[model samples]
Structure formats: structure tokens, C-alpha cells
Target: MLPFGRVAIIGLGLIGSSVARAVRATMPTVRLTGHDADPAVRDTALRIDLVDDVAETPGAAVIDADLVILCVPVRAIAAVGTEIAPDLPAEAVISDVGSCKAEVARSLAAALPDHAIVPAHPVAGTERSGPEAGFATLFRHRWCILTPVDGTAEPAVERVAEFWRRLGATVERMTPDHHDRVLAITSHLPHLIAYTIVGTASDLEQVTESEVIKYSAGGFRDFTRIAASDPTMWRDVFLTNREAVLEMLGRFSEDLATLQRAIRWGKGDELFDLFTRTRAVRRSIVEQGQDDAAADFGRTHD
Candidate 1:
């Protein structure tokens, strides 16, 4: 269990609520309070016993909190940090669950108090959002990357790392720039590709639509699942990590074009070679235990 005295989570969405539930389940002695911009979300969290107390505002929730975790969309994180900054107690450890680390870390450090701001990203979530979609084990066995910026206290980072470790996650420390670039390829690009393919399919005429749905198992179905992730969350991710994502997308498009040409020319050898190389990448991921063998070439999580 974490040794935190008081922990407050802002934004009672899926990630926020999940953190609250995990903390309560694992560290029952710690005081937990929660608040969300949406009053309905706060009420729902209270009703579900996800938090020990519900605060009327971010300031009220973070008051005297040894750990303050922001679980809001990336775009809203800075504003929320500012709102809670004045109420933050000295030596408090502030952190976030934002996907894009560099921008979030920079913004929060600028807006929040000069306490310990340890930016983290938990690489686990479902397509669902909102308080009702959260679960205590959502972060179990997941990778939680902590990107503590310059001037961040070592003890504060360790405390946040321990907190995630207690929640059944493997914690790793990374630089914000490295985290942004890696996730741009591993996560952001994939999500963007999924959304594009699904949007293109939806724009097709009524003629082949029925067949598209019927034969979706050919690979389109997986894209549909990624496309269904929370729109607001994804929108914020892209906007916040624009540079890294664009750089990755340029390379991805070139590779995709090469594959398209190989298919058009009926070059079986080229296709086979490309597939074999990609398969090795999958094997490497499984060997590293980043994904389970049952997840199909590390394309899906669980």
C-alpha cells in the first residue's frame, strides 16, 4: 500500500475513478477525496463509493492532499492545475494520467505550485469513458511511465512510482521528450490510422456497406474498436502531441504507400518479406512481455 496521507483525484472520469477505486482497495488507510467539473460525475462517484469524500471544487479537493492526481483530458489539465495550485499544500506531489507527457508536464509545471509535479501515463484503458466505466483493476499489470521534469523532487517521483506499483503496475521513469516520441508511434499513430480507416469505410456508398460489415473480421473490426475510443480524449491527445504525431505519420504514410504498391503489382515476395519482418517485431514484444501471446501480434491489449 502507498504511504500517502491524503490523496485527491480531480476529474471523475474513467481513469480518475479507476485510480480512486484502486487506491481505496489497496490503501484503505489513506484519505481519498474526488471532484469533477461535471457535478453529475461527482454525484455518481459518491453514489458508487468510489471516493471517501466529494469536493465542490478542485481547490477544495486538493487542499492538504499529499498527492493530487489529475485525470482530465490533456487540454483541460493546465486549467485544472491552475485552479488547484493555490490550494496545494507545500511538499505535495502532483501528477497526471495524461497520454501526451511533454506538453502536459510543461503546462502543469507552469500553472501549478512549485511542488513536486510528477507527470505519468498509465498505458491501460478501455474504449469506454466516464465514472461508470472505471474498475479497480484497470491498471493491473499495466505500464505506468513517470516523466518528471527538471526541478522535480526525487522523493516525490519515488512516492508516485510506489503508488502506481501498489496498484499492480510496473513503473518506469522516462524523459518527457522520449515518452512523447515513443507514444506518438506506438499509440497515437495507430489510433489515428484506425479513425481514418473507419471514417473512410463509413463514407462508402450503400452498395458495398452490407458486405463491409459482414466481412469486417478480415481486419476492419479491430480498427472499429480503436475508432470507438473517447473522442474528446483522442482529440486532446493529437492536439497536444502534434509535432511527434505528425513526424511519425509522415513515415507511416510512406511505408503504407510502399505496401499499397506491392499489393497493386501482385508482388507476393515483397508482401511476404514485409509481413515476416513485422511478425518478428511482434515476437520481440511478446518476448519482452509488453503484451501477451494471446493478444495477436501485440495489436490488441488483452
Candidate 2:
């Protein structure tokens, strides 16, 4: 049986549009409804025929949906939940794509007290935004983490997991708190570092802006790509997951200080050992199929 017959997506940005496209590709018969806060986005969604129907409001989109997925920023999850609560079907399973789970779970529970909320984070995306930036294969080989509250019904959680599985994602379940902590180190901290590095490069008085751009190396280019991610989304992610992010940031700061001391004192062995261990981590990620080992990260030098 299909996990969901009618799916509604709130927020027609990259993730939302990608879900609509993935559903259409994998489950042709399933109905799709989508809505976005921006009228321009809604118009773009219609122009692209992104869904079976583009509703004018959040509530309208979920009125007949079997599953509703919120793809907005983390800070906006609660307001969207409250907006759609009145129209959600009694048995509809609610899920979201927000990175922070603990605050999102709490917000969702508070907004829709009687609903079966299954918060999810699909660990896939690019430094792109808007409806036209989405592709049907975005979730292929990606991990989708589901963090349902303690008392959520098993069937509802399974349905959400099955939904992600059908979209070509491997599903894993974890507690909201644990999910936040793990993602803090794996995802959030990396983005934070990227933004800081890119910002620092831009603010250097020793180099002219044009000079910085002209001499950009591979590492700085990659950091700029990470920093180019949606500001609103990252802002909310940092704020919503502040505790875990801060904890991970503190650990990172201490490690960075150690590296600084090693470089200053000519501790070549210490630096070499740390670099070797970290290089193994990159290799492991590639071995697990999480990244490409191709030369220059699969970039075409031509």
C-alpha cells in the first residue's frame, strides 16, 4: 500500500519543491498539494506545474492531505504548524525538514497537540534555493532522520519512514536531543565555520576585495559555496539549535587553539598526527558512499 495517498508540502522552496518532484517521480498516482508564504514562489510553482494543486494558504493545502511536510525555516515551523492545524485531517501524519529536532518537536507538539507529529531531517541539499532549483533525485542515497516524540504511534512513524524510503533515502530514528547533538557536530558546526572563514576573508584589510576574489584557491572556493546557503535558514538553524551548536563550537575552539599552539611552537609531529587522523575521516566518508573520492571532488578542470 502507498504510505500516503495525498501529500501536502508547505513552503515551495528548494526542499519543498524537491519533495513534490520526488513524489511525482516515485509515486505517480499520489496526489500533491503545495503552498508557500511568498506569492511569487506560489506563482513560480504553478508555472513549473510543480504540484497537482498549489493552494493559496497553508491550511488549504493540508485540508485533504494524508501527510503534510513543512519545509520552512526552523523558527517558522511552529507558526506554520499552528496555521495548518485546523485544516489537517484527523489521521494525517505531520513531518518537517528542519535540521533542529528538539525545538521543532516542541514547537510542533505545542502547535498541534492532537496530531501525530514525526519530525524529519533529510540530510541532503545544495547551496541553492527557490522552486526551480529542486530536482527529483536530490534525496537519492541520502539519510533521512526521523525524531518522533516518545508517545507517537508506531504506525505513524513507520509511515513517515516508508515515505522517505520510497524517495530513495535511508531512514534512521533517533531521539530529538540526540539528533540535535549529532547534527550540531556533523552539519551545523561545519556551516558555522564556513561562514566565519568566508566572512573573515572578505573583511581582511590587507587584501583588496578584487584581489581576494582573484586569488581564491580551492579551499576558499568551497567555503564560499557553503557560506552561500540561505541566510534565513542558517540563521534559524543556529538559533534553534544554539545549545548543541554552542557545545560543539566550544570543543572546536579548544581543538583549534591546540593546533595554533602546535604551529607556533614548530610541533611538526603533533600537526602531522592530527592531519593523518582527519584524512582518515575523509577517506571513511568516501568509503561509506557519503562523498565522492574523484580528483578535486569530481570537478572538471577543463
Candidate 3:
């Protein structure tokens, strides 16, 4: 069990609700509370017994709580942090599950006091949004990155890691800048590309649009599934992580042009070599257990 006396989760969205449910499954004795800006969500959470108690706002949720998790959108991190900053318990540890870490850390630092405020990004989620979409096994066997700011207490960081570990996540430490840049390429860029291609396909003429949807097999269908992810959440991610994503996109465009040229010129050797090299990378990832063909379908469940 975590050393935390109380765990308060703000914003009962998909990620928040998933964590809340997972905590209950993992630690039944821990005192848990829920808060959300929307009253309907709070009421639903209460009806479903997703939390022991429900609060109306961020301050009410964190009062007397040892661990407070901000599980709202990335854009609202600062505002939520500011609202609960003054009322935060003196020894409490504040953390977040926002996708973008650097922006969240900068905002929370200005709002909270000299307490431990660890910015975390649990690399697990689903295309679904809202409270009903959450599940108890969302974080199981997934990676959770903690990016502790300078001056954050070591004990507080360890306690936070313990909490995540109890819920079956592999905890890893990273600098906020590094986390943001890496995710920009891996997560953010992929989502952006998915949304863009899906949008393009939708904008095709009526006949072509129907054909595209009808013929969508593994690749295009996979993009569609990713593109179906929460729009507001993704909009906030792109807006906040603009610089890193833009830089990555530029490089991606250059490589895409090369691949396009190769395909147009029937350069079979270049295509074969590129595919072989990329296949090796996939093999290395599989050997390290980062991915498995058997589990590819399982990722969609989260």
C-alpha cells in the first residue's frame, strides 16, 4: 500500500476514472475521493461507487488528502493547480497524468507551494472518453513515466512510484523535456498523422469516400481507430506540445518524400532495404518485450 493517507483524483474522465477503478481493485483500504468540473460526471461516479466521496471542485477534493492527482485535460492543468494550490495539504504530493509533462510542470510549479509535485504521464489510454469508458485494468503492465521537477522531495517521488506500482505499472523516471520530445515523436505525431489522414479520407468526394471506408483494411482502419480518440484531449496535446511536434513533423515529411520518390520510380532495392531495417527494429522491440504480435489486439482494449 502507498504511504498516502488519502488519494484524491480530480476530473473523472476516462483516464481519471480508469485510475480510480484500478486503485479500488488494487488497494481496497485506501481512502479515495473524486472531483470533476461536470456535475453529471460526479453524480455518475457516485452512483457507480467509483470513489468513496465526491467533491465539487479541485480544492474540496485535495483538502486533507496526501496524494492529489490532476487527471483533466493538459490545457486545464494550470487552472486546476492554481485553484487547489493554496488549499493543498502542507505535506501532500500533487501529481498529474497529463500526456504533456513539460507544460504541466511549468504550470503547476507556479500554482503550488514547495511541496512535491510530480508530473506523470501514464502511457496508456483508449479512444474512448468520459467516465463510463474507464476500466480497472487500464494501467496493467503499462509504462508510467514520472518527471519530478527540481527540489521535489525524494520520499514523495518514491511514494508516488509505489502507488503506481501497486496498480501494476512499470515506473520509469525521465526529465520533463525529454519526456515531451520523445512522446512528440512516438505518441503525439502518430495521433496527428492519424487524424490528418482520416480527415483527408472523409473529405473525399461522396463516391470515393464510401469506397475508402469500404476498403479500409488493416492500415487505414488502424488509423481510423486512433483518429477516433478524444478530440479535446488531442487538441490540447498538439497545442501545448507544438514545438516538439512541429520539429518531428518536419523530419517525418522529409523521409516521407524519399519513400514516395522511391515508390514512384520503382526503386525496389531501396524499398526492400528500408523495410528490412525497420523490421529489425521491430524484432529488437519484440525481444525486449516492449511489443508482441499476440498483444497488439490487447492494446485496443485500453
Candidate 4:
């Protein structure tokens, strides 16, 4: 049986449009309805025929949906939940694609007290945005974490899991708090570091901007790619998951200080050991199929 016959996606950004495309590719008979706050985005979605229907309002999008996935910023979840609450079907399962889960759970619960809220975070995306930037295979081989609060019906949670599985994602469940902490270290902190590094490079007075661009190495180029992610989305992610992010940041700062001291004191053995361990981590990620081991991260050069 199909997990959901009718689906509504609120927000037509990269994730939202990708979901629409994935659904169409994997489950052609299932109906898809989508809405975005920006009229230009809505027009683009319509032009691309991204969904079966492009709704003008959040409520309208979910009026007949069996599943409504909010793809908006974490800070906007509560408002969007409230907007769609009135028209949401009684048995519809509400999920989201936001990275932060604890706050999303609280926001959805407050906005729609009677609904089944299963917050999800798809651990996949490129440094791209907008309806036109999506692809049907974005979720293939990715992990989608579902954080369903206590008392959420088992069937509803399973349905959400099955939905993701059909889209070629491996689904796993975690507590909202645990999900926040794990993602804080694995995803959020990395983005934060990337943004900081890229920003610092740009603000250096010793190097001209054009010179920095001209001499950019592989590491800095990768950081710049991450820093190019949507500012609004990253801003909300940092704010919504501040506690965990801050905790992780503190730990990172201490580790960085240790590395700094090692470099200053000529502790070659200490630095070598740390680098060896970190290199193993990269190898492990590749072994687990989470990343490519191809030369230069699978990039092609002419």
C-alpha cells in the first residue's frame, strides 16, 4: 500500500522541489501539492510542473493531503504549522525537512495540538537553492532521520519511514534531543566552521580579494562551496539549534586551542597523531559509502 496518497510540500526551495521530483519519479500515482511564500518561486514551480498542483496558501496545500512536509526555515515552522492547521486533514501526518528537531517538535505541537508530528531531517543537499536546482536522485543513498515525539502513533511514524524509504533514503529514528546534539556536531558545526573560515579569508587585510581568489587552494574552495549555502536556512539552523551548536562549538574551540599549542611548541608527534586519526575518519566515511574516495572528491578535470 502507498504510504501516502496525497502529499503537500510547503516551500518550493531545493529540498521541497526535490521531494516533489522524487515522489513523481518513485510514486507517479501519488498526488503532490506544493506551496511557497515567494510568488516567484510558485511561478517557477508551476512553470516546471513540479507538482500536481501549486497552492497559493499553506492551508490550501494541505486541505486534502495525507502528509504535509514543511520545508521552510526552522524559525518559520510554528507560523506555517498554524497557517495549515485549520485545513489539515484529521489523520494527516505532519513532517518537516528542517535540520533542527527539538524546536520543530515543540513548534508543531504548539501550533497543531491534535496532529501527528513526525519531524524529519534529510541528511543530503548541495550548496544550491530554488525550485530549479532540485533533482529526483537527491535523496538516493542518503539518511533521513525521523524524530517523532512521545505518544506519536506507531503507524504514523512507520508511514513516514516508508515514505522516505520509497524515495531511496535509509530511515532511522532518534529522540528529538539526541538528534539535535548529533546533528550539531556532524552537520551544523561543520557549516559554522566553513562560514567562519570563508568569511575570515575574505576579511583579511594582508591579502587582496582578487589575490585570494586567484590563489585559492582546494581546501578553501570546498569551504567556500559550503559557505555558499542559503543564508536564511543556515541562520535559522544556528538559532534554532543554538544550545547544541554552542556546546559542540565549545568542545571544538578547546580542541583547536590544543592544536594551536602543539603547532607553537613544535609538537610534531602530537600533530601527526591527530592527523593520522582524522585521516582514518575520512577513510571510514568512504568505506561506509557516505563519501567518495575518488581523487579530488570525485571531481573531473580536463
Candidate 5:
């Protein structure tokens, strides 16, 4: 059964496009309406048939939608919410794909006031962007966390959870603040470190751009891939999730300093113990099906 009769998507970037494709693949009968702020993206979405209809504006897209998913950046959610509020159906559920949940939940509630708001974060993506980068299988076996605020309708939350499951995602519910703090360490901090490391490598006097690219090891290369993610989206994530990100970042810096002192003092035992423990963490992730045990993270075609 289709959880939503008519679905509206605001934003036509990778995640938005993926949602469209995934929905079309899994629920061929559901009517889809999509609107992107960029004309070029709207055209691309139409060219590729990403949605059933390309709306001229946010308000137009959600005119009669039963479920509206905002795939815009975290900072823009409030503005988008306000934009669509007038045309939004009274009983329509408003949700989002923003990584930062706490602020977004607050923003949507403030902007819409009377709508059933349930914010979600699909903990899935590639180091890619644009409408064409989407795939129907992007959310397969991945986690989609719903951070529905207090007083949200129970059935609305359940419908949204079921919708994500239909799109191939495993669903979990968490408080918005807890979601933000957890993601700060799992996602936001890693992206920040990647961006910094990749930037530092580019500015190194001894290493030319060509040399850096040519000698990029798997570790550095992976960091570069993550660093290459959409800057605008990540910028909003950091700005909105600043408190949690900074807290996690401070802990990370302290740990780094400890490692630095250990290396300088020839504390091989300390290094070995940390590496061993970290290796076990990786093993646990693989065993839990969070990642593949295959070499190169199963990128190889073997």
C-alpha cells in the first residue's frame, strides 16, 4: 500500500532525485510532484523524468500533497517551509532530508505552526551531487532516522516511517537533539576533518597538485572523495549543527593531541593498543552489515 497518495519533493539535487527514482521504482502508482529552486535542475529533472510533474515553485508543488519532503539544505528549511505553508494541505505531512535534525524540527514547526512535521535524515549518500547522480538503490539497506518532534500525530509519523521502508530503508526513531549529537560524531566531524586534510594537502609547498593526485593512497583518496561532497549542503550542516559538531571536534582534537604526544615520546604500546581497538570497531561494523568486509569496501569487481 502506498503510504502517501500524492508526494511532493522540494529540491532536485542528488537526494531529492534519488527519492523520486526510488519511489517511482517501488511505487509506480503514487503521484509525484517536485520543485527545485534552480531552473536548470528542474529542466534536468524533467529531462530524466525524475518526477511525475515539475512544479514552478515550492507552493505549487505541495498544493495537494499528502506528504511533502524538503530535500534542501539545513539552513534553508525554514524559508522553504514558510514558502510552502500557504499552499500546504491542512493534513499534509511535512518532512525533510536535512542531516541536522534539532534546529530543522524547530524551524519547520515555527514556520508552519499547524502542520504535522516529522523531520528525517537518510544516513545514505555518495560523494556525488546533481540530479543525474541519483539511483533507485541509494537507500537500500541504509538507515533512515526520523526525528519527529513532540505532539506530532502518531499516524503521520508511522506513515512517514512506512514510506521510508517502502523505499528500501530501515527506519529508526530518535529525538531531534540526540540525532544531532549522534550525527555530529558519525558524519559532521568526519566531513570537517576530510575537508581540512584535503585542503592542507593542496596547500603543501612540497607536493604539487599533480603529485598529490598521483600518489594519493586509498585513505587520502577516500578523504578527498568525502571532501568533494556538495559544499553548499555541508556548509549548512556545519552552521546549523555547530554546537554538537564543535563538541565532537574538541574531543577529536584532544585525542589527536594525545596521539601526537604518544608518537613523539615513542609510545608504541599506546599506539598499538589504540589501533587494535579501532580495528575491532571496524570489524564490528562489518559483522553488523553496516559495511562490507570485502577489500576496498567492496569497490572491486571480484
Candidate 6:
């Protein structure tokens, strides 16, 4: 059974468009409408047939939607909620794809006090953006975390979870605060570090951009990929999830200092042991199917 008969998606970027594609792929019987803040994007969505219809405004998009998924940036989630509140169907379910769940949940709760807001983060995406970058298989074998607050209907929560499952995501439910803290460590901090590493590299290589490009084949390529992610989306994530990010960052700094000391003091055994342990962690991730051990994220394995 389809979880939602009529679905509307706000913000037609990679995630939003991907959701549309996945929905059409898995549940062709459901009606899909989408809206973007940009008219150009709307045009492209229509040209590419990204959704059944492109709504002119957020208000119009969710007027008859049984499920409304906010795929906007973290900072914009609340405002988008306000924009569609008047048009949101009385019994419609609300959800979002924001990285920071706690803040977004609070914002949505304040905006739509009567709705069942189920904020979710599909731990799936590439360092890509825009409507054209989406694909139906983006969430395949990935995890989707749901953070439904107290008072949200159990049936509504399950419906949203089932929706994600149909899009090829394994679903897990957690409190909004815990979801934010966990994502800060697992997703936010890693992206922050990737951006920093790429920036630092570019700064140091300013005098010789050519050679930096030459050596990029070794390791810089991956950092560049991560750093290539959409700027606006990542910016909001860090700002809204600052508390959890900073907490994880402090621990990271302490660990970095320890590693530096080990290297400086020529503690070969300590360095070797740490490397071995970390290597096992990577192997375990591959074993669990979170990633593949092959190069190019198993893309080239074929």
C-alpha cells in the first residue's frame, strides 16, 4: 500500500528531485507535485519531467498534498513551513530532509503546531546538487533516520518511514536531539573537515595550481569531491547544528594532538596500533555494506 496518495516536495534540488524520481519509480500510483524557490529550477524541473507538476509557490504545492516533504536548506525549513501552513491539509503529514533535526523540528513545530512533523535525514547523497544530479537509486542500501517528536501520530510516523523504505532506504527512528548529535559526528564534522582540507590545499598550492592538480590523482581527488558539495546547504547545517558540531570538533582536536605527539616522539608502536585500529574500522564499514572497500566507492569494481 502506498503511504501517501498525494505528495508535494518543496525545494527541487538534488535531494528533492531524487525523492521525486524515487517516488515515481517505486509508487507510480501516487501523485507528485514539486516546488522550488527559483523559477529557473522550476522550468528545468518541468523540462526534465522531474515531477508531475511544478507548483508556483509552496502554498499551492501542499494545498491538497497528503504528505509534504520539505527538502530545503536547514535555515529555510522553518520559513517554508510558515509559507505552506495556511494551505497544508488539515490531516497532512509534514517532514523534512534537514541535517540538523532538533532545530528543524523546533522550527516546524512552532510553524505548524497542529501537524505531525516527522523530520528525516536520509544518510545518502553525493557531492552533487541541482535537479539533474538526482537518480532513483541514490538511497539504495542507505539509512534514513527519522526524528518524530512526542505527540506525533504513530501511524503518521510509520507512514513516513514506509515512504522512505519504498525509496530504497532502511529506516531508523530516534529522538530529534540524538539525531542531531549523531549526525554532527557522522556527517557534519566529516563534511567540515573535507571542506577545510580542500581549502587549505588550495591555499598552499596557489603558487602552483598545475602541480597540485597533477598530484590530485593520489588523494586530493577525494577531498575535492567532498568539498564540491552545495555550499548553501552545508553552511546552514553547520550554523544550525553548531552545538553538536563543536562538541565533536573538540574531541577531534584532542585526538589530532595525540596523533601529532605520537609522531613527534617517534612512538612507532603507538602510531602503528592506531593505524591498525582505524583500518579495521574502515574494513568494518565496508563489511556492513555502508561502503565498499574497492576504489571509487566500488564504482570501478565492475
**lDDT score for residue 133 of model 6:** 94
lDDT of 4 by residue, 144-259 (tens): 99999788999999999999999999999999999999999999999999999888888999988788787776468888888999999999999999999999999999999999
Off by over 4 Å in 4: none
> For model 6, how does the per-residue alpha-carbon lDDT over 122-233 read when each residue is reduced to its tens digit?
9999988999999999999999999997899899999999999999999999998999889988889999999998777777744576777788978888888878999999
Residue 62 Cα positional deviation in candidate 5, in Å, after optimal superposition: 0.5
| Runs of candidate 3 exceeding 4 Å displacement | 295-302
lDDT of 5 by residue, 141-254 (tens): 999999998999899999999999999999999999999999999999999999999999899898798888988864788899899999999999999999999999999999
With a 3 Å backbone cut-off (N, CA, C), the pairs that clash in candidate 6 are none
lDDT of each: 0.90, 0.94, 0.90, 0.94, 0.94, 0.92
The true-versus-predicted C-alpha distance at residue 170 of model 4, in Å, is 0.3
| Clashing pairs counted in every model | 0, 0, 0, 0, 0, 0
Model 3 residue pairs with clashes:
none
Q: How accurate locally is residue 225 in candidate 2, as Cα lDDT from 0 to 100?
A: 85
Q: Model 4 scores what on Cα lDDT?
A: 0.94
lDDT of 1 by residue, 150-215 (tens): 988788888899999988899998999999999999899999999999888878886477787899
RMSD of 3: 2.4
State in Å the error of residue 229, model 4: 0.4
TM per candidate = 0.94, 0.99, 0.94, 0.99, 0.98, 0.97
Return whichever of 3 and 6 wins on TM-score.
6
Q: What is the lDDT of residue 282 in candidate 1?
A: 81
lDDT of 3 by residue, 1-302 (tens): 45676999999999999989988998888899889999999999989989999998778888989999999999998999889887888989999999999989998988886778998889998899999999998898889999998999899899999989987889999999999999999899999999999999888776487788888874688799899999989999999999999999999999999999999999999999999999899788778766665655455654
